[model samples]
Target: MPDTGRSERGAVSAARTRDFARFRHEALLLKALGISKPLIACMAQRAAVTGTSIETEVLASGAIDEEAYYGGLARMAGLPFVAEIPDGMINDGPALDCQLKEPTLVRLHCNGRAPVIALVPKITHIEGLASRVKRSACLGETIVITTPSAIRRAVWKAGGERRGRVAVHGLFQATQPLSARTVVTGDQGFSAGLLISGLLMLLALAPQLLMIILHLILSLFHLGGLMLRLAVLAHTRRHGSEHETMLQSADMALPIYSVMVAIYREAAVVPQLIAALDEIDWPRSRLDIKLVCEADDLETLAAIAKVRPGPHFEVVEVPAMQPRTKPKALTYALAGARGEFITIYDAEDRPHPQQLREAYHRFRLSSDKLACLQSPLVIANGGESWLSAVFALEYAALFRRLLPALGFYRMPLPLGGTSNHFRTAALTGCGG
Candidate 1:
């Protein structure tokens, strides 16, 4: 039998053909919108370098707003453009979640007139859609056009209740122990109380002995911790450079890397945040960047929408549930993640461009046991103050020395919150 581990040459050729078609369609779109040839050429080169689509480069380059560009297509196709789709007109459910990932079409149900499909009409299919409308006059009743954002908004409204419930309680329902729904388990609380009471009694009855015993226990605990950190640091220093070259370039078929940022009351951080994220060296088409915001954080949400991000960017709204924490927001949007690898970043984080590629390469080389990789977190503005200097040094020691050391010893690594790369399976298997 032939090998099934990889695509055959014919399959590869067909995929390349599709890429050409995508580029051609995007070129048509650019030309119709009066985009200059020089800019188009520049975008094409950037797309080639990144292994992304021309549309992606154009969108990321900020040459034009996403809605305005789509509106240009609507005008060219002779279809009406809708800035927003009313909630009641569109039926939505969890099944329609695919639309959320790659928003293309939505069926609208009106009161009096015939039902119309609101599509983010592709330039490649403009003629095809128009021909069908021509053949069946009633079909042309209204194949109205809308932006991806509008389609996303309508879908979010349609599946609010179900999606919100899943976001809030899906992990708990799947695996209660893995969830922090109940911060302290009943058994743990009882044990803690018993220990506290015993400690108090000992302290009161035999102060000198209790002090000596407690001091030894505390000292050993810390000593062990320090020894472990130091051991890991030394081990890493020995073999860290062995695979550095191998991790420079990732595999040809790069999996989608989901980058999720949980934003709350950081409206002012949006511009720089987006800019920093865009600096990541990855194909925009295969990147699923979710700017997850709480439902009540309208300011940040509005700021994100105002930017008019490309199709690759999604604005995931987490329900304002109890324990409105960053973890909760991230977990809420986990259901919509469409990547094989997932990573989280803070609004202020500016990760190195090759960080994803480096992590991905290491993951592929390592066995299945290698589930996660933490990118080093460095503070660039450490010279600002004494507090900043200490923070920077702490980060350098923890991320650069301790984390690698722990990994070298094959011990559990406490992942650095930002710039962490993880296998999607590992993440979801542990209840997301």
Candidate 2:
């Protein structure tokens, strides 16, 4: 009997040694797998040293409590212990009576050396439990838990609270009205009232009459200009080679010409303008293309920035204080002009390639009194819509028929808005 007892004790000692050996091996594996040291330690406490058995419990509310078992396995296998809590656990309360009654589970998802706990409680008492847990855990270090729906509700409540706080602080109120008295003489008051009434009447009637008069004047001017340009073209054809020779000789003396494009809220048409400019036959290096833009216009700024307008392309941000008009912007840009000749193109302009060359030649041959040469603006997209069709016809009569006639007669030419090339010095002389 004595011998048998001694033999049993020896066997038990060997078994203990084997269990320790297995545990050490498992711990080494967990370290190699990047499992956090703290989590591994917690798992080792709950699990059997040798990893022979795993304990699992399904709580009363149908949540599986495999923390102890999985934690241990993770330690042994060197893997993270992740728990996927059911959605219902957060939505529904826990069972009425259980060992861990009203228990809240905190689950966290994380990277690095920290353990994350996301909590799902199965009972009403656990409703506000996460906030308390978060506060306490935050005091130690930090713990992030998933509570999306709860967080959303909290944010909404916070917004309402802020609104209520603002409501309490009412708007400022003036204590008293400002006082001033009018010292009106009888004649002055009567005269003032009569003047105001007259002004109102004029405002009502004057615009229509003014518009009619302006239209009549514009029509007459346009007709006269057109007729003159045509006559000039005819005369030039008859006069011939002398003028052509004079122009070719002048090109050698003049500096490269520059084109100025003024844009404001014109993002839609800018790309088309760029495409047209690119298609022009002029040497790119010789063309100084200035794209003038208002400083405040973001859309146009962004669109223009994306275009890699090679060496000759320059973006000039015009100050807002300048007159808020296309002509004003052009005038401002002209102040910095370096070319011997300059031309203006609107955001939608598509000038003929030969237009610049033609203008340059004309200026070279003509007298300095020909300060400005107005080029005909042909509407390319004329028949696309009713508005366009009318515009096309109007332009055809103005450019093709009338302007040339006006030039021939040497009459004062009211310039077309765009594609009007001028001798740079002449334009600068005309109020820049």
Candidate 3:
């Protein structure tokens, strides 16, 4: 009996040795498959010390990309390798619940009425999730392998997008009271009222003196404003003909451009707007084009939908708020902008094709304090009427002459409402 017990102990020790040997063999295989020695060692140590699988350790550490690791596992396991799940294939079913736990790594779907769970290989926790889906979904579950991005996209489609839209995110509040703060200041109206009241009282007390004082004040105000304008105009004329820096092709890789277009009652101009956006010389993938629309503007929304812009284009629906103005609409869209640089475009305006590129090059060349650039605005309808011609000349004077002079002299540059390019950080720093 004692000899029998000894033999049993020996058998148990041998089994333990074989298990350790298999662990070492797998680690060696991973190294042989071109995984770095340090990564293989980490995987082995994690497997032995923390009870984590080798594959899980490598994937979690990002030593190897998901595709290579999972594709290898799928081949070894004789399962299909799926890079991306088709859109609209996974509904909010029990299988979707399985994906929610590790949305970035796992996705569940149905393949020809057969439930399939796609996962990054060697994720120890996903087995139980798969089992739960198999029992509830009723269809036999098959396992496949896919990239991390694919799984994340599937999870986002399952419910994440709706959650993102409804999350409030404080965008509106960040740029709130935009009407009071941006366009028309509250203090301006109050000051105007006080001035008018004081003038009326002065006129009632002494009509001749009041008239003389009013005339003097009006003359000084108009003269000062005119002098300031003239100075800027003179400076602009001096520098107007100087050659702008040529935008190089290599410089294009540096910036992600944000284009914001605020549209209201311009449903008829959506096509033109789209065409103008398409004509921009910047890369489409790097462009963050935001089509800002009012919540109630269904016609514009329908028009945008019909245009069907690429993935980079997003239609931001501004919630109805007080002081509905163009600046307010832009503030609403500014909250969701994702780019290093930002610009505003009006609905009917078609900017020059090289404008964005030129702006980017200028920003790169200028000092850090140079926060904004005003692109020259020209009237396309100048020949249509005398009024249009006059309007064109006015715009040319303001944008081409006055604004550049203001910028050169370090004076406050008033924005031209459109075709204004700004650094995103600088704009947001000034309250979006």
Highest TM-score: which candidate? 1
Q: Is candidate 1 or candidate 3 better by lDDT?
A: 1
In candidate 3, what are the lDDT values of residues 1-432, reduced to their tens digit?
379988999997886575567567566656655678777765665554334457545654545776777676555545568887787766654344344323444535455566667766453433454455456654223667676556655654564334333323334446566424355468987999899999899888988999899899999999998999887767766666557667865532545688999999899999999988988876444567889887788999999999877655767766655555787677656655667899999999999989988888898888898888888889889999999999999988787777767767777877778999999889878766
Better of 2 and 3 by TM-score: 3
Locate the minimum summed-lDDT window of 10 residues in model 1: 243-252
Deviation in Å, model 2, residue 180 alpha carbon: 36
State model 3's lDDT.
0.70
Give the better candidate number (2 or 3) by lDDT.
Answer: 3
Write down the lDDT of every candidate, Cα atoms only.
Answer: 0.80, 0.55, 0.70
Name model 3 segments beyond 4 Å from true.
1-198, 236-240, 320-323
CA deviation > 4 Å runs, candidate 2:
1-254, 385-387
Candidate 2 backbone overlaps, count: 31
Worst 10 residues of 3 by lDDT: 161-170
In candidate 1, which residue ranges exceed 4 Å CA deviation? 1-65, 72-79, 112-114, 200-205, 233-243, 246-255, 301-312
